[model samples]
Target: MASNVAQFAEGEDPQQMSSDTAALQDQGWALDTDGMGVTKTFHFKSYFKAVAFVNLIAAESSAKKHHPTMTMRIGSVDVHWTTHRPRGLTHKDIDLARHCDRGAGLMGAVESGQGIKCGPKN
Candidate 1:
């Protein structure tokens, strides 16, 4: 399991997040900024594949004791990761995002799409 807790000092800068977000994006992960926490979405080819990807993420998140909001759509699975208790993005979030990226690659899913689309209102 990837490390859910990272060495983050207080008052992390948004620019730092941009850099990390870019890195994750390059690896086929979508980053969401229009919320209290960071979100990412991964696309697959079929419902079974999508569910399988979610299961892998579930195991990883459970092992870390950190969870993400997950959604299953036609041929896709969206995962939003953030440290809600603290109300901000953290290294843990980025780490999980990276892990999700790796899982996507392992499953032969290409990360190519528009940036995260805001989910339904509230």
Candidate 2:
């Protein structure tokens, strides 16, 4: 809903949205119970990698003019994509979610168990 994004762009149709959301869900993204957005948590080997991933996302979002809500941690980042203007999921959301998957891979994202955690060691 930023001035940079197209004001006329709208959310996807239910049918098309189903398939689009499904693909992201298979990649670990979860559809919001309210059916308005999608979320995923990407893990990394170190704090540096995690921060790098966030930066990667930031660059892409800026270029696309569609930003996501990101919560960064020592070894992970939780990303939620939703079109505020459209008030639901849209093509931009789908595209950006896929970009996130690709970026995470490039950043050496790891499984939750394998990721570095900021806490006392066992």
Candidate 3:
């Protein structure tokens, strides 16, 4: 059976999600209090790379039908994910986050100072 994020509510007991949150946070994601969202920052060596990454994320967001609030600066990109319809966190948010992480990982992006690359090496 698939897990439903709607089963959880904001400001309620987050014990069940503590571990997941910890893991994601360790990957450089943080919670957005006001938006009830999660955010992650990615640093690139150049402005063009940063913007390209942001564009990649934007394309993915549109494909997923879940959009994140993004801010792209010279050398950094910040992405915040949340469920705008219900106005809080959801499994969709978490799933989308993981997808974003995977996409970043494929591009040789670093998260929390660690380089992440997806897929097994043949």
Best by lDDT: 2
RMSD of 3: 9.3
Summarize candidate 1's per-residue lDDT along 80-102 as a digit string, tens digits: 78776566667778888888878
Q: Which stretches of model 3 miss by more than 4 angstroms? A: 1-18, 110-122
| Colliding pairs, model 3 | none
Per-residue C-alpha lDDT of model 3 across residues 16-87, encoded as one tens digit per residue: 555565667777777775536788888665566676777788887888888888887655677888776655
Candidate 2 lDDT over 5-76, as tens digits, reads 122236457777777777877788887656677888899999999989999999999999999999998888
Superposed Cα deviation of residue 23, candidate 1 (Å): 1.4
Best by TM-score: 2
C-alpha TM-scores of all predictions: 0.69, 0.87, 0.70
lDDT of each: 0.67, 0.83, 0.67
lDDT, candidate 3, residue 115?
A: 30
For model 1, the superposed segments whose C-alpha errors exceed 4 Å read 1-18, 28-36, 111-122
Mark the regions of model 2 whose C-alpha exceeds 4 Å error after superposition: 1-11
Prediction-by-prediction clash tally: 0, 0, 0
